[model samples]
Target chain A: MSTDTPANSESALSPEEVAELRSRVDELETELSTLRTEMDDDSKKMVIIATKGTLDMAYPPLILASTAAAFGYDVTVFHTFWGLEILHEENSKDLKLSSVGNPNLPVPNAIAALPGMDRMTTRMMRGKIEDNDVASVEELVRTSLDSGVDLQACQMTIDLLGYDEDDFYEGVTTGVGAASAFQEMVDADIQLLV
Target chain B: MSTETTETLDVKGQNCPMPVIKTKGAFDELADGETLEVVATDAGSVSDIAGWADSTDGAELLDQTEASEDGETVYKHYIRKAE
Candidate 1:
């Protein structure tokens, strides 16, 4: 960051330059602690990222977050873009699983996107999940919060989607900006981007 | 369900995240230094639970074992809550 670095190839750093460099080192150390104080300083911290809004993709991050919290790590889930809808009141209640454009979907993409196909696929998906005894999205969200996994919604995404505080589920933190969430994730010892 | 078990979490037939999700719920209710036994049918729990326990500070994973029964593999994890 210094342009005054020994302009002459053979010359060493001048005393003034050396003094400036040492001062810069001190400034850096001071800034390091300040940045670290940016978020909750839990000893064992974990972050789960939910960037995909699809119904199926929603479960992984929330489930992992709850479990990680149960393991005694403080956990936070940062949702952005489509992922933010996981906290939407009505949407989360009956989150629809889609086979459209998904390789894992049994039906062809074109067929999967047909009218009435979403409903059929959703029912089938729900039936299979229920039959397997997998935890439902609502159950997982409640469990995640109870397990101390903080659910944070992205401020930018919320505004971009034209959602208000009333739109999100109860207990969902709605004002988290990316800069703050990113810093929190950076401080966490373990992080998962799902 | 036994009193001595502190907590017993049954995640039978549930997959990866389900097992862990249940475990976290049960574990959070425990007082510091309490123990929990989680029984899961998901094969993924073996590493998933281990990774989780290792990543956190207060929870100490005593052990994890896998056994095959009736043609199904079950994983059990024993963890002690940190004081």
Candidate 2:
């Protein structure tokens, strides 16, 4: 901003003063336009921390990420601990649903602990998903990837679990630390933990 | 009040996120100020589409209506690209 001031008197003004005022107005206009451009460049972002790797738990983060991306939001999902299994090329499809200790499962805990019960529960859940026309975990993962959602795997978890980086699906940002993921979460308009 | 639809998208039988996802793809192909009409069977789309349009830039939700076709309920949404 310029410090120059216009005289309040009803007297005629000098040409130099008028020119200076006009230039000052031009500078302010330029600054206003720049500010507007910067505001327009800022896009909404969403971040989710996926801590559960169960078959049913994986759907929430993936669904939210894909949907947010569809709404034109920049989305990122940080997979840590057991959640890293979602990015594993083979484990993604092999995820199992545990019926034991889950009140939602009508079966008794003793029965749920029987041999092959987990497999049976997983199969039943898959059937329910198919009957409802809902998307499978595989489909949702593929959709998230296709929609450009960032799937970041925690590097510390991978090292602790003794998992190979090459086992993850293509396009996954493996080896991301907590600090990097937190940076994204801080900038995101929405953050969730599942 | 005199706006006309510029494109139509059919997402019947699709579940959560698919209807919204497909709508996004269709909207991308539409020109500015153009309108898109989406037909869906997912009951959840009523709220999903509304929420999506509310959050998305350049998207203006015009209206949403419900109807029954061949013994099945259907939802239709009209949105405009206002950017």
Candidate 3:
């Protein structure tokens, strides 16, 4: 680098010049703060793909979407495949927690396959949920809707499952295809598959 | 430090998402510059409340304190409504 001493190196700026510089700094500061506030108000977006239907799997997407909404995020949960069971009017409340094929299940595989094991496991898990003060899946879904989180069910999945458009809970957006879900996911600041 | 109205929200015995969710609901009812005092028993709320405040433009976390009540550790957070 070439070091060059400017003619003003030994001279102080005039009072008028200092005042102009101070005003410029103030204007810049104002602009910076305005920009910051605008950015914050714009709010971030989050999108989640919920593809599981079991009682154990339902909580993640709903809980995350609701929490993100609470944090002032524009949140969306796209339900596809078995995930649509979460929004199903009749099936949501009865979604079962199965022990079969779940390594996390404490019981051995053979015992897990016994008759009525799924119901037993579901009841046990629900008890644990209640003891810990965890909100139920139904409560979380309602909370998500009340907090302005978009809950969309896949149109293709509904047709595949022979479910009517009105099969989901009220306020749930029906008939969202993969393309629309992708549209939401592409612009989101955060995306998750659960 | 302003004399704006301060509201108290007790989320004791609740876990993650509940505390934050209830805090958001309470803040929605607050006027701009009002303060909200949150009392929670969840250990996760210490970071959850702060993170929520930091990320939400309409909320500002002012202070956090920890205390023991009935042999259970409690967390308190002071947040201000920012419009």
Candidate 4:
């Protein structure tokens, strides 16, 4: 009948303590597994579709894709339609901003009506973005390349539009047809049309 | 002196993951136990930096400071290299 008997018992742990200890062991096991997983490459995949050529519309997709790549995720950018223009190295340098036919573009009415409106619109847009401290489309392209974002131009669109590889910026991946692009889209975890 | 080194990257004008991406590249070039300092302008970067440091294991966020520059708020982060 000594109190030492109870204190020295093999089953000294109370039910609450046993439960808490089990929970702690589980947590430690989870943390170890998470650490191992982080060390492993099980990277995420993201796909972005760039179908518009306007400066405002161009940066978002590239920026997002590059940013995702920086975070250890594989990113692919599919350029189709007007978006393919951004990949054109030669034309990209002189790509004009168009406000006339672009409905989604935000432009002042008077400026949108000017002669050679596209050039004027481009200047206005560039100025506005600069004023707000945003990077230019060219800068975005450079960043995209530096970040290793896979840039794929639509071959069907390129041929249909009479474009050659020389027209696209450096670091662009091989031009793929529509079916390839569709396959890529289906394989991605995230699909964004920007 | 333990010879531990720390580097700082200023990406105040950069938005989104530029700060984080560039920081990752910088971290890659450092030896284990080195440190990195990152300054970012993207509002989301505050949380992103902390999250990246936590998830990367060997890395730990030592400090984070937010300051207003030219009417924009920029975040400064100090990360220790852990691996």
Q: Which residue runs does candidate 3 get wrong by more than 4 Å? A: A1-41, B1-5
Q: Given candidate 1, what's the lDDT at residue A66?
A: 75
Q: Kindly report which residue stretches of model 1 are placed more than 4 angstroms away from their true locations once superposed.
A: A1-42, B1-15, B24-83
- By the DockQ metric, which is better: model 2 or model 4? 2
Residue-by-residue lDDT tens digits, candidate 3, A1-194: 54575646557788899999999999999999998987777668999999999998999998899999998889999999999999997899899998899888799889999999999999999999999998888888899999999999999989998999888889999968989989988978999999
In candidate 2, which residue ranges exceed 4 Å CA deviation? A1-41, B1-3
The per-model DockQ list reads: 0.53, 0.64, 0.62, 0.29
- By DockQ, the candidates rank as 2, 3, 1, 4
Q: Which window of ten consecutive residues has the lowest lDDT sum in model 4 chain A?
A: A2-11
Task: Report the C-alpha lDDT of model 1 over A98-131, residue by residue, as the tens digit.
Answer: 7677787789988887898878888988898888
Candidate 4 clashing pairs, residues 3+ apart or interchain:
A89-A167, A89-A168, A89-A169, B58-B82
Task: Give Cα-based local distance difference scores for all models.
Answer: 0.80, 0.91, 0.91, 0.78
- lDDT against true structure, model 3: 0.91
Question: Candidate 4: misplaced stretches above 4 Å?
Answer: A1-41, A100-111, B1-5, B41-44, B51-59, B68-74
Q: What TM value does chain A in model 1 reach?
A: 0.76
The per-prediction i-RMS, to one decimal, reads 2.6, 0.9, 0.9, 2.2
Candidate 2, residues B1-83, lDDT tens digits: the string is: 55489999999988997999989989989999999999999999999999999988899999998999999999999999996
Residue A109 CA error for candidate 3 (Å)?
0.8
Candidate 1, true inter-chain contacts retained: 0.74
